[model samples]
Target: MTKNSAWTILAVIGAIVIAWFLVNVLFSLVAFVVKLILVAIVAVIVYVVMRVFVGGRDDRR
Candidate 1:
């Protein structure tokens, strides 16, 4: 193969590796954000349930 063709192949491979690494990092970030949102939603639901069922007492401390 010509030197130019060999260099082109190497560049393509390097690009693919970089793209793969970036995609993995992106997915990890997305997963963490999704987990955080889910936890927040569940926490809010639990808080509402507690307020409704257990209720806050008007009694003095």
Candidate 2:
């Protein structure tokens, strides 16, 4: 009986640790995705600004 209880406790602890790591990993993934989206948004804004300055000029001679 004692051995069985000890095994159960160990299993529960292991499961909790695994769950904690999984949650952390999911959060990190979400953070990374958010950063990627932010970078894309900034890039698009920069491109538009550059186009207005560089590409919208009339060069008719």
Best by TM-score: 1
Window of ten residues with lowest summed lDDT in model 1: 52-61
TM, every model = 0.86, 0.83
Question: For candidate 1, lDDT tens digit of each residue in 1-61?
Answer: 9999999999999999999999999999999999999999999999999998777754677
Encode model 2's per-residue lDDT on 1-61: one tens digit a residue.
Answer: 6999999999999999999999999999999999999999999999999999998896985
lDDT of prediction 2: 0.98
Choose the strongest candidate by lDDT: 2
Model 1 superposed RMSD (Cα): 2.1
Supply the global lDDT for candidate 1: 0.96
Candidate 2 lDDT score at position 56:
88
Q: Model 2, stretches more than 4 Å misplaced?
A: none
TM for candidate 1 is 0.86
Q: After superposition, how far is residue 26 of candidate 2 from its true place, in Å?
A: 1.0
